[model samples]
Target: MPSVPLHSSATPIVSAVLAFDVGGTDTKAGLVLSAAPGEVPEIVDIQRFRTALDAQRPGPVLVDFLDGLLRRYATEHPQLRIAAVGVTVPGLVDEQRGIGIYAANLGWRDYPFRAELESRMQLPVSFGHDVGAAGDAEVALGAGQGAENAMILVVGTGIAAALYIDGRRLRAGGYAGEVGHAMAPAPDGGLQIMEATGSAGAIGRRYLLAHPDFSGGAREVLTLAKAGDTVAQRIWAEAIAALAFSIAQAVAMIGISKVVIGGGLAEAGDELFEPLAKQIDQLLSFQPRPVLVKAMLGQNAGLIGSALKAQELLSAASSEPSTGALP
Candidate 1:
């Protein structure tokens, strides 16, 4: 619900765009209306649907869902012109080719999303990595506004990163920001990757493995840790350690000025940030410690990002330069 009040009820809606964010477990579609002067753009008529997917071949189902939504919106809002469509999905994405290179959760490989969406909708399409697009919104409209070199690190069922360096996003064919896979010291005295040890899903999975009766995720695990459960404490500590190690590495390599944490685990607030900050300080020597902050746009960042993508598409097609700000 990104909204701003218009001054007058008589003012007409200038235009709107269709935006879809295909997340791991759900898909969200909404209409992003362009704001008139002195008003903020808003995402209205939002719909959330459980992602009904076929892991091996997700494109057809996804495309069908999007098309239906688009048609419905068109019928519902006849007054506003929908200029473009933006779709973002989790996975390795090649923005230049408009291909979803791969997604571990969704299990699609090299799917030509832009071509499929364009063929059906007949509109200018913008496609990108889900976390990357969310990062764009954060940079432009949230915590990362003034930073030249920053990162948006999303720790959820899995982990991914969006790198902004030299004041521009680094796609590198969608291979630039897979930091979750980086190696870290495991709590069991061996090496493990950050995602396996630190992600919200990983933390829950680890705790569940330790105590089969515990029917909850990282949140419950954190609660148990605070209540003096040794098993939960160990698991929570490992998650923190793994995350801190990975972040310090990014700071060393890229000199990241700010790391805007997003996704479910960020919901933990101080429990995640405080210890992660302390550990990161312990790890870095010469590298400047990046400022760690929670994402301001919350879960809506990706959706807003999709809207921004659509707006940009329309702007480009009409030969109008886009400022890349959130609509």
Candidate 2:
């Protein structure tokens, strides 16, 4: 139920792009009035609001929340006309259709997001998979920039990845990069789920569940392992091993030359990267070794990516001759 403030300006009206990074817990919105390519979007403003996505009817809740945000944003910058609006959401998105196919976190299915928002806001809209958008932002502006072949892995509430090959973003029906759910060979000699064993949330949760007395994050687990906490050490090592397996698989398949890791778990820094690199290195002799690096954009990657998408859409809309929807 929060509202943003509007500001009035006498300056000549300028084209603007609005981008929203809609998450289960929080929503980030940015308004970029103008900027050149390769320059940071001139952010007029950025705001974050709590998302009530836990409601039984999350679709409407989210829609209303977005509408309210946009309304406030528009009210503030009435002089500036919006060229495009880009929304990034977590789910199996139909980017072409601008529909939220299925989001377990948001409880949305087949929602016609693009048409709905366009009708409500009366502007061009672009939709993208949340993580994929983040990957695009990274490749275009952050850690993966200039890499011909690279992968961006974000390990947060869940594990998701984005692939960039030769400057083209790969989207295999919005199902291309789901590395977290991939089944991994258990380092403990049993089948283990990748996210369950490798994600930062999973690593911390598993350890805490097993050892209620321990208090810390994935990094603490690694520290405990170094100090001889058998259970902690085992879980930490297992997670690293599982991660390496996934990276090596990606390397072999895509011939990825670089891998950028981000998200909450990635905060472990060398504790995560060094060990993961070693494991992946030891696994393959001839397969080209992918340079593993941490994500540079951090939490803002999604917002930045969404803004870039908005900018791209705005640019595209300016060029394409407008016509009625094609059957």
Tell me which residue pairs clash in candidate 1. none
TM-score: which candidate is best? 1
Give per-residue CA lDDT, model 1, range 1-327, as digits (tens).
Answer: 978676655546557888889987888888888765323358888889787688656877778888888888888887677778889998899988999998877778888989998898888889988899899888878877878899999999889999999999998998989998888988888998889999999999999898888799999999999999998998999899999998998898888879999999999999999999999999999787789999988888888888787777776766756444332
Clashes of each: 0, 2
lDDT of each model, Cα atoms only? 0.86, 0.82
Score every model by TM-score.
0.90, 0.88
- Candidate 2: clashing pairs of residues: 6-76, 7-76
